[model samples]
Target: MSQATETLVFIPEDISSARSGAFRADWQMRSLAGETMGTHWSAKFSSPEQLDLQAIELSITQNLDTVISQMSPWETDSDLRRYQKAASGSWCAFRPEAFHVLERALSIAQETDGAYDPTFATAVDLLGFGPSPHSGYSYASPEVQQAFAQAGYQKAALSAETNSLFQPGNLRVDLCSIAKGFAVDLVCQRLRELGLENYLFEIGGEAKGLGCKPDGLPWLYEIEPPPNAKASLSKAQVALCGLAVATSGNYLRYEQRHGQTVAHIVSPRCQDGDDKLLSVSIFHDSCMEADAYATALFLLGAEAGLAFADKRNLAALFQTADDLLLSGRARKLLG
Candidate 1:
């Protein structure tokens, strides 16, 4: 029988180098976890002082709650839903957090040429993957076609000065692809504000790490293998020092319809999910970017996605049924 393999990738750093001060003998590893956005979030950090764990948890939960209030499509009163309900041509003001996420989402949509549109909420709902009851609409159905017609990120406009978004006649916005990662970033920021530096923060599967462990070792994160992967497949892990990683795949959230496998990730380009690649993982300095890029690359497929990553010099790993493909930058990270 073939044995499984493991690959550790990291940027070389001195063992004695510590961004959060030299690891103290008294420093202890602390952990916290909570539920949010129909998922779980966790944190592991090194701290020397006797910190109030309860207070830290409260702050983290509050930060996550703020993201849901502003961006969650399931929340009827959320800023995103409110904007969706607004009449066309009217500009709706939003909180700084919501505005920031929307701005970034649009920027990415433009960058990927609508491959990662934020205005595909209607299509997502029609395909039985979103908050609304699925309409049982096929890709050729009128409902699905109309949804696709209206699903263009260019239709929307943002006013940075006012922190507002213009709704272009029933344009529905969904930030599901990027919101959770933003929440992770928010938690990391909160940790820093609380004077804790050496930490690994994660929401759902997206994660970001700061500083180093108490023993001066970087926090290591193992990429999740695809479902039913062979035992001989090599496991790849990266040291999460000052980096965030996100993975998108069809195996996690997909359904069978009429003998067709429909994934949850609805591409704006085609109004259907693309399962050509088993999964795509993106590594960046920001969790939000990593999360959005992972979804985009998954929709773009293996060939085009590889080209996109290479053009941007992005660190990306694309996994197919028979092969593991890494971008030029990704290959450099292997130790």
Candidate 2:
């Protein structure tokens, strides 16, 4: 796998603490890592004593399983799958977790003018990047068009009072864009419940951090260069403190279909031409939101994506073929 060149490292204060043995004597740094959502996840925290590492790892895995059960497009028995097969115009209630994710998705779709739609499952599957009944279909085929026509995030009516969702027609929902980040956020919460105030949690490259190291310094992450780029390239690092970051890029995930290479990300607007934008990274208070926005910004390409980010005052970094651009908000925050 191509690695993100930027690695998180302990700051000078942390090095000093390690040398003095002031923090290590009183606190133990424990770590757990495992697989989730077709990728790996990890958690690192400082605690005064040894923890039930086995139980904590199991809980983290179970949490990821719960998310997959609710959102995986590959699973036929998933709640989303059942909803997709349900009769049109029928109401399907969601579990609390699924409900919350869908609610946020719909809101983001509206906010981005459908830039980050959960209803792009058809296009995604058609591209052979997702599982489905729609795979192997050409992008311009009637079936793909019909599926796109039938799906729209706006059409799905939500009722918070009843915790029920009503599909206007044959809309199929896929939560791939934001589900992993939500899982990361959930793990962070679990860590807090274990009385861990200083920790970092990551799932599928989307990460969030809280508090600080025992030495009172923040966790740092080096944003990597685009995939396939020479690793000798350097990028900036950001300190994580009650913040989450997510990156979306086609360089990492794409497949050749019909003699043409198509990326995994599908734009609801129209076919993207000569996709020049390489990658996008977003920072936000919520990992889920960061994930969703990263995808949206990537779909919008460089110019429009930068404009949108600036308009929303979002902290976003867009990497193009030749250079890296930071939104005004990102510069203000990271500069």
Q: Which digits, one per residue and each the tens of the lDDT, describe model 1 over residues 176-201?
A: 99998899889898888998879899
Worst 10 residues of 1 by lDDT: 10-19
- The CA lDDT at 40 in model 1 is 91
The sequence of per-residue lDDT tens digits that candidate 2 reaches over residues 147-170 is 777777878899998777886666
TM-score of 2: 0.87
Worst 10 residues of 2 by lDDT: 9-18
Per-candidate TM-score against the hidden true structure: 0.93, 0.87
Give the Cα error of residue 128 in candidate 1, in Å.
1.8
- Segments of candidate 1 deviating more than 4 angstroms: 1-4, 12-20, 268-274
C-alpha lDDT (0 to 100) for residue 93 of candidate 1: 94
* Candidate 1, pairs of clashing residues: none
**Model 1 residue 290 lDDT?**
93
lDDT comparing candidate 2 with the true structure:
0.76
